[model samples]
Target: MASGLLIEEGEKMRTEEEMFQMILEIAKQDERIRAVYLNGSRTNPNVKKDEYQDFDIVYVVNDVIPFLNNPEWLKKFGEIAVMQEPNSKAFGWGGDHNEQESYTWLMLFSDGNRIDLHLDIKKVALDRYLEDTLTIKLLDKDDFLPDLAKANDQFHWIQKPSQIEFHGVCNEFWWCLNNVAKGLNRHQIPYVLKMYYEIVHPQLFQLVDWSVAQKNNFQITTGLFGKYYEMLLTKERYEAYLKTYPNPNPEAIWQAIFNACYLFRELGIEIAESLGFSYNLVEDQNMQRYLTQMYKKENDK
Candidate 1:
């Protein structure tokens, strides 16, 4: 539709069905394309669709060499605005052996639709994708693709936490407060930011993730790094969580570090109580006081 994808039969805009028909039509023309499938968010039943969601397609073929070398085949799908072929020499691919059997084409169409298409050698490696719960088979001529046990969101569900694991996070959260103070005192942004993210924030997110897991009886996901916190968290708790983010200035960063400590202490207590573990109030109080003292001294200097 952009320029050369051939909006065939006098169609102006290429719709979803039309795109699928175009993909399948190309596969039908070639004997090598033995199977067709879809993966990623497009196959996830829970995910909401928008114009930006990519059409993740996989073509299981007898061979991948022709598709690898030929650039003409790509234009058939649509006028490609931009294309990334990862395993190609032109794209900094190592050599022939690295990707001899499989290849990838991340195509962006002119009409704002994108498709991440992969061409793989049939039978040997294609079965690996069939097992993933977030996949749907579009076509299989010779019954090559296997039957999955069941396709569901079980792959991302939250797992139960052990006491040792739980304690480790609480200890890690309180201990790392010193590092952030040290970074702030030294006027080093990297150290402060790193300690906050790699040490402090993981625990913050983990506590929230644990809270969600507890509320849901460890039966659901918290998304990738508590992205679904708003959905699962109470409005009051969520509003408090929002106050923890601070601007990059020294004073703001100082306030943010304390905010994080308070939030973590609150969430950690709830989670520890729920899990029947002891929450270290002594460590929390000691760390909070130490952080305040360090911040005050740094400002006085």
Candidate 2:
């Protein structure tokens, strides 16, 4: 029984207040539930509010045994369109908590609403609570949740890199670029693209974002792999990043490789400058140009 109802065109979707009220009402009836907390985007002020935001709720229960043993306890909320227990062996967690026993259930309702509910029996510690992005104490019977400051942007702070970490990131980015070159030479389009996406892109974007954060005091997300690079980068520089993508023609593979080299060199230089380290952009450019010409000549034969 699955149904998708598109809300009236331009009608306001259900609010967080409405969802929270419903969760609270359920908690009030269940005495075993000691406390309730919320996490994820709903707690992050920086994140824009929209219908897509999920209600990530947690219930601190007295004993998780009854709930964990019987699957039917979840029906009290609403008709579950589908449910996933990440902690269950079927999915992954295997009902084992090394430190303290806690169970998590992830649910999606029929009305396009979702909740990540966790039931923990242990006492809520303040230090551990603050480690995650954002959390709010919704209800407390014994009043275990700490009296902490409201959620802030500190959770996503840009950590300063050690000398070793800096070198490691540079080494990884350069080494992975070799795989992209190899894949292109062998005419393996998927392999080349995968290597670029998995290794080169993340390092390049992370470096750029880290530099921006250092300059501006680490306030923004940089939007998931420089997806919003236009907002953060100059038109010229953003255009350069865009040009890094390789054209599909086997004959044009060398051009693509050259593009990757150009983009990576630029990113590396940017990273080094931000960290006050020296970089050899000229050396990279020479090597890249030589390789591209060699590949082009070989393919032309």
Candidate 3:
């Protein structure tokens, strides 16, 4: 049982230091928890640190059921903005039903801080947990945990697309754009947005990502949704990329689809040339022509 030096409620928002102390205190009080560790962005030196980054914590306990049963125990951390027990069978998680292997409680506090906590059962073995390069041991009472390797971004580093991956992404992007145009004509706003954002945009983004990676020798990252893309992108290409997200109006949506098509075409070609992978230019041309004709037909109506 960990000593939750319970931070009293009804006060100013708790700081990061207070949060870590409270977490360590909880581990200290509970003899059942033999060790603790941190993971995710917190341990990655490559990433610029931020307040919103999750405190990816792991509590190595001999048994998991007691903590699983007692959900209220988490209230000690702070005024919880929100919390989720994602791995529980009660939550309908499919695999191992969050078995003794490990379970999780992802939490956000009112103070604008979040702690993504995992309770890894001791019986699962230390070697399994150490596999993630983004891991750091916080506390080990019984010396149950071992000296893990230092954290690295190896797991997340951008990888050069294989010929199959490059070809597939190009095929999917060009193929899905027609769905957006058709949805627009049918006044299926949601459907069009879904096709563009969910289906086509990912591939477009990936193509642009490949362009970035091609320049950097496929080593650095652009982060989620190209948060770091601007720093890496040529000014002209980045501006064109920004315009791809248009207003929900049908005309704007149509234009944005064309914008994305042009960007993807050039980027895909560049990536293909650099990587020596084949590009589906004919499919790209056919889709562009189809979109142009569709736009004219819809306007004429």
Who wins the TM-score comparison? 3
TM-score of model 2 vs. true structure: 0.80
Model 3: lDDT equals: 0.82
Over 1-301, each residue of candidate 3 has an lDDT whose tens digit, in order, gives: 2222233355465666887898999999989888988888878887887667789898998888888778678877766766677876666764577565677888877766788888877766475576777888889998867787778767666898899999899899888888888888889999899888999999989988778877887777777778877888889988999999988899999889888988888888888889998888899999999999999989999
Tell me the lDDT of model 3 at 125.
Answer: 44
Where in model 2 is the C-alpha error above 4 Å? Answer: 1-13, 92-100, 124-127, 223-260, 294-298
Error of 3 at 180 (Å): 1.8
lDDT of each: 0.79, 0.69, 0.82
Q: Count the backbone clashes (under 3 Å) in each candidate.
A: 0, 0, 7
Question: So what's the TM-score on candidate 1?
Answer: 0.82
Worst-scoring 10-residue span by lDDT in model 3: 1-10
| lDDT tens per residue, model 1, 92-177 | 66467445577888888766678898888875456567556777788887787876654565677788789999889889988988
Order the numbered candidates by TM-score, best leading. 3, 1, 2
lDDT by residue for model 2 (59-141), tens = 88777788877767787766566777776776565756522456777777766678788877745434446677578888888
The lDDT of model 1 is 0.79
Please, what is the TM-score per model?
A: 0.82, 0.80, 0.89
lDDT of 2 at 20: 87
